[model samples]
Target: MARQPLAPVRPPCRLYLITPPHIAHLDAFAAQLEQALDAGDVAALQIRLKPAEEGDIRNAVQRLLPIARAMGVAVLLNDRPDLARTLGCDGVHIGQEDAPLAEARRILGPDAMIGVTCHADRDLAWDAAEGGADYVAFGAFYPTATKETAHRPELELLSTWQETVEVPCVAIGGITVDNAAALARAGADFIAVSGGVWAHPDGPAVAVSRFAAVLAAVAEEI
Candidate 1:
C-alpha cells in the first residue's frame, strides 16, 4: 500500500498547544481543545506525556485526536514514535534527549511528520535535519512558568536557525500575543506554547485566538 500525503503546512496562524501530563481533568481540557478548534485557533496539539506511560498517553490522544481531526487540527505525540505510529497521529516531536532520528524514522516510515528539539544550538538543528527531522524546536525564549531547565535560547539563535535550516523552526517558552510578533520577525516558523495558552485567565480558546490574530497580522507584514 502507498502512504498518505502530509498536510500542507498552514501559514503561521494560531498557537501550538503542548499538553502537560499533569492535567487531571482530561475531559475539561478536551472541551478546551474543542474550543481552540472551533475558534480557528491552535494549528496543532502536542501530546507531551511526562514520566512516560504509553497507555495513558494513547488514551488521551485517542480522546483528543478525533476532536482535533474534525476541526482540521494536526495532532502530534511527543517523544514516542511508536505510539504515534500506532495511533496514526499527524506527527511526533522528539528531543535531543529522546530517541535517535533513524529509529524514529524507521518506525514512523516516510510520511509521519517529525519535529526535533534543537534546544539553543545551531549545530543540533543542522544535525536533526540530516537525521530526518521535519521541523526544529528552540526554547526558553522567555522565562517559562512550566518546565525548569537551565538553558535559555536567544532571539539571535532563531534567526540563525531560520537561515541555516530548511525545516520550520518552532519558538517555545513564555510566548504570548505581546512577544509573538517579535519572535515571528525573528523568523520563528512556529510559536509553541503551553502556559501561554492554557493558563490565560479567560481561557485557552481566547488565548489561542489572540496568538492566532497576532500571527495573522504578522503574516500580512511578511
Candidate 2:
C-alpha cells in the first residue's frame, strides 16, 4: 500500500493546572499559583481540594479566582458544579463518579465549560462528547502520585480522538516537561498537571515555563 498522509495537526496543546488535593497555606499557594500562571500559557486552573470543608473551598476560590481571571485563565472547580455556579467559576470538571453529564450541563448552563473525566474509556469519551461536553479527559498516561489511577490510556487513544472527535481531549496524570511534548504530538489539546508543576524542584513558575517550552517545540514540529 502507498504511504498515507497524516491528518492536519490540531491546535497547539496548552497547560491545564490542577490544584493540589490540599492547600495548607492559602496565601502561599495563591502567590505560587499567580506566579505559575504568569509564567506560561495555562488554559485553565481547577480548584480541586479534597476532603475540604465547603468553607475552605469557597475561601480558596475567593482568593485564587481573581488571580486566574486577571491572567485571562479560566477557573474550574472539580466535582462541584453547584459551587462552581454559586462561586462564579468559569467551569467545572466532573469525574465519572461525581455527576451525570446532563445534570452538570443543566446546573452550569449552556455557557459554562464542563469537562468529563473519561479516563481510558472510549465509550465514556464518546458519550460525554455526544452529551455536549466542552471537553473529554483521558489519563493517567504516566503513574501519578496526585491520585490513584487504574486506567492508563494509550497514546493511540489521543491520536484516534484527534482524527475523529471535535471536542478537545485533555491528556492528564503525571504530565511534566519531560513527557508533555509526546502527549502534545499525540493529539492532546490540553495536558493536565498537578504534582508535575507544584512539586517541581525549582518552583512552580519554572516548571510552567519549562512545560511551555516543551509545548512550543511540539507546536513547531507539527
Candidate 3:
C-alpha cells in the first residue's frame, strides 16, 4: 500500500522509557524514575512487568503512574488494555500477539494512546496505522537482553517509514545513547529504551541526558 507523504520537517525524536521486566522495589524505582524524567525530555513511560502476577502489576502502576504523569509523561501499560483502562493509564502498548488493535481502542476509548508493535513488518505497521493506532513500533534494531527478540529491522525501515507515514513511528529494542543517533536520523519519532537507560553505569539520569544530547544533534542535522 502507498503511504501518505509527510512534511519536509519532522519533530525532534523524543525518548520513551520502559520499566525493567521486574521492579523489585517500587519506592526505589519510583525515585529513580523521577530522577530520569527530571534529567531530560521523556515523552512516555511503559509499565512492562513481565511474568508478574496481576497484583504486582497493579502495585507497580499504583506506585509509578503518578510520578510519570506528574512529569507530563504519558503512562502506557504493556499488552493489557483492560488493565490499563481500569488502572487509569494514559494508554496501552499492544504487541502483535496481544489483543487486536481495534479491540484495544474499543476498550481504552477514543482518547487513549494505543501503540502497536509492528516488529519490522511494513504490512503490520500499515495495518496498525490504518486501523487508527496512535503509533507503530519497529525493532529489535539491536540485540537486547530485556526480552527475547525475533525480528531485527534494518535502518532503512525507519527512513522509509519516516518519509511516508505521518502517524508517528517509534524505534524500540536495544536503543541506547551510543546507537540512538542513527535511529533518530533514520526518522524515528521516539526512541524506546529499557536496559539502555535503567542499567546505565552512571544511572538512568545520565543515560537520559546523554540520549537527549544524541537526539538533539540528530535533529539539527536532519
lDDT value for candidate 3?
0.95
> Backbone clashes in each candidate structure, one number apiece?
0, 0, 0
Give me the overall lDDT of model 2.
Answer: 0.95
Overlapping backbone residue pairs in candidate 2 total: 0
Give the candidates in order of lDDT, highest first.
2, 3, 1
Per-residue lDDT of model 3, residues 141-178, tens digit only: 99999999999999999999988888899999988889
RMSD of 2: 2.7
In model 2, the worst 10-residue window by lDDT is 6-15
lDDT at residue 167 of model 2 (Cα atoms):
96
- Each prediction's whole-model lDDT (CA): 0.82, 0.95, 0.95
lDDT of 2 by residue, 126-200 (tens): 999999999999999999999989999999999999999999999999888899999999999999999999999
lDDT (10s digit) by residue, model 1, range 1-222: 899998545355346778865667789889987886677566788998787566778789999999999988789999899889999999899987888888899999998889998778788888888888888888878888778766788899878766666778889888877898999878888889888777888887888778878888888876
